[model samples]
Target: MVTMTSPAETAPTPRLLALRDAVREIERHAADRGWDGEVTASVFALVRTTDALSATPDLAGELPETALAEAASDPEHLTSIEQDGLPEATTLEELLAQLAWPEQVDGAAVVVERLMVPPEAEQGLPQDPEEAMAALMAHPDRTDVRLAAGVLRTGESWCAVRSRSHDTDDEVAGSPEAVPGLVEALRATFR
Candidate 1:
C-alpha cells in the first residue's frame, strides 16, 4: 500500500513562497527603521488577516461583521495603534509609498489609523472620545480622521452582518457634526 502524506507536511507552494518572501521584505524594512513592538505586531496581524482573506474570499464577507462589532464596542483597539511608538512620519510616508497592493492598502490603513489618529485626536482635542472624534472629523485635515472613520465604519458594517445579525443600530454611530466641512476639505485636496 502507498503511504499518504498529510497536507500540513507538504512543502509550501510557489505562491506561499512568494508571500513569505514579501513578508520577509516587510520585516527587514521595519527592522531597518527600528519599528516598535506594537507596530511589528500590528503588521503581522494585518499580514495574517490578508492571507486568510485571500485564501478564502468568502471569509471576507464574514470578517467585517465580527471585527466591526468588536471595534465599535472597544474603540480602544483603534486608539492603541500608537502603543508601539509611532514611527517617524517620514518613515511611515516611505512605507506607504512602497505599498502597491490593494491588500497592503487595507492593512496599512488599519495600522495607520490605530497609530496616528487616536493620539492626534487625544493630544489635539478634548479628552472625551466623542468630542475628540468630532473635532477630528471637523479638522482642516480630516482625511486621516475620515480614513480611520471609513475603517471603523467598514468594520462595524461587517461585524453587524456576521456576529449580531439582529442588532439594527448602526455600529459606527457618532459622526462628527462638522462632517460637511470635512467633506469640503477632502474635495479641496490641493489646498
Candidate 2:
C-alpha cells in the first residue's frame, strides 16, 4: 500500500519547528529591549543546541531548565548567539554582504527595524538620505515594523514580523518568506 500526505499535514518538520522557535525567541528579546530605540540591524548565529552548550558550559547553567531539557533531547534544537562589533556599513545589504560563516554555524538570523509610510505617502520625498528618513518619521500614517528572518545551511527558513502598533506575542505574524530578501541573504552566508 502507498500513502500521500497533504502539504498542511507535513509542513513543519522537527528541524523547521526548532528553527521557528529560535527565530521567535530572538524576536521576543528584541521586543523586551523596548521600542525607545534606534533603527537597529542585528545578526545572530544559530548553532546546534548541543554544540552551543558544550562551547559555553558556564552559560548553560543560566538557561531555563525547560530549555536545557529541550536542548538535551532534541538534536534539531538551536541556540542563537548574537554577532557584535560588525564592520560599519551604510546599509543593511552592505552589512549582510560582508558576512561569511564558518562551517560549524548551522544557520543565521537577523532582526531589522524600520520606520515606513504607505506607498502613497512616499511620493515627492526628499532626495537626501537624512531628510528622507526625517520625512518618513514625521508622516502622519507612518508605521514602525520589525522583521526577523532566519535560514539554515540545510535550506530550511522562517520569518516573523511585528509592527509597533500591534506589538504583542499573539499579534506577531510569520511565514516561510515573510522577508524573502533577508532570508535569501542569510542563506548566502552559508554558501
Candidate 3:
C-alpha cells in the first residue's frame, strides 16, 4: 500500500515562512507611512536575529529576555534593518548594480512605488528614459503600485504588491515568485 501526501505536506519551509513575515511586516510599515508617490525606494537588509543583536547591541533593550533568547537560538529567525534612502535621481537597476553587501547581511529587500500602465500603452514610448517616464506618468490609464521584494542568501524569496486602487492590508498579494525581476535583482546583491 502507498501512503499519499497532501498539500499540507508540501508547505513552505520555516525559512520561507520567516521571509514572508518579514516582507509583510515591511510592507505594512510602508503602508502605514501612506503613499507619497516618491521616486526613491526604501531599502532594507535582513539579518539573522542573532547577528542583528550582536551587530547592534541596542536592539537587546527592545526585546524581552525570552524573546531575545529565542531569537538568539533560532537560526531561521530574521530581523529587518532599513538602509539609507536611495538617491532620487538613481534608478533601482542602477543602484542595485553598484551594491555589494557585507558578510553579515544575509539578505536584502526594497520597497518602491511605480506608475504602471497596460502593455499597449508602452508601444509608442520614447527612446529616452526621461521621456518614457514622463509618458508613463502622463498616461490616463496608469496605476500606482507599491512593490516590496526580499531575497535571502539561502535562495529563498518573497514579494508583496499593493495597488493604490486596492490599498488595504487584506488586499495585498504575496508569493514567492510574484515579481521575478525584483527577486532576481535582490538576489544578486547577496552574491
For candidate 1, what is the TM-score?
0.21
Candidate 3 lDDT score at position 58: 99
Better TM-score candidate (1, 2): 2
Q: Which candidate, 1 or 3, has the higher lDDT? A: 3
Task: In angstroms, give how far residue 98 of model 2 lies from its true place.
Answer: 0.6
Which of the numbered candidates is closest to the native, going by highest TM-score? 2
- Better-scoring candidate (TM-score), 1 or 3: 3
Cα error, residue 153 of model 1, in Å, equals 14
TM-score of 3: 0.82
Please write out the lDDT profile of model 2 over residues 51-127, one tens digit for every residue.
87787798787778878899989988898889988978998888998999998899999998877688988899899
Question: TM-scores for all candidates?
Answer: 0.21, 0.89, 0.82
Consecutive 10-residue window with the lowest summed lDDT within model 3: 1-10
What CA root-mean-square deviation does each model show from the true structure? 18.5, 4.7, 5.3
Question: How well does model 1 score by local distance difference test?
Answer: 0.31
What is candidate 3's CA lDDT for residue 92?
A: 88
Steric clashes per prediction: 8, 0, 0
Off-target runs (Cα >4 Å) in candidate 2 are: 1-9, 36-39, 54-59
Q: Write the per-residue lDDT of candidate 3 for residues 154-184, one digit (tens) a residue.
A: 8999999999999998888888878899899
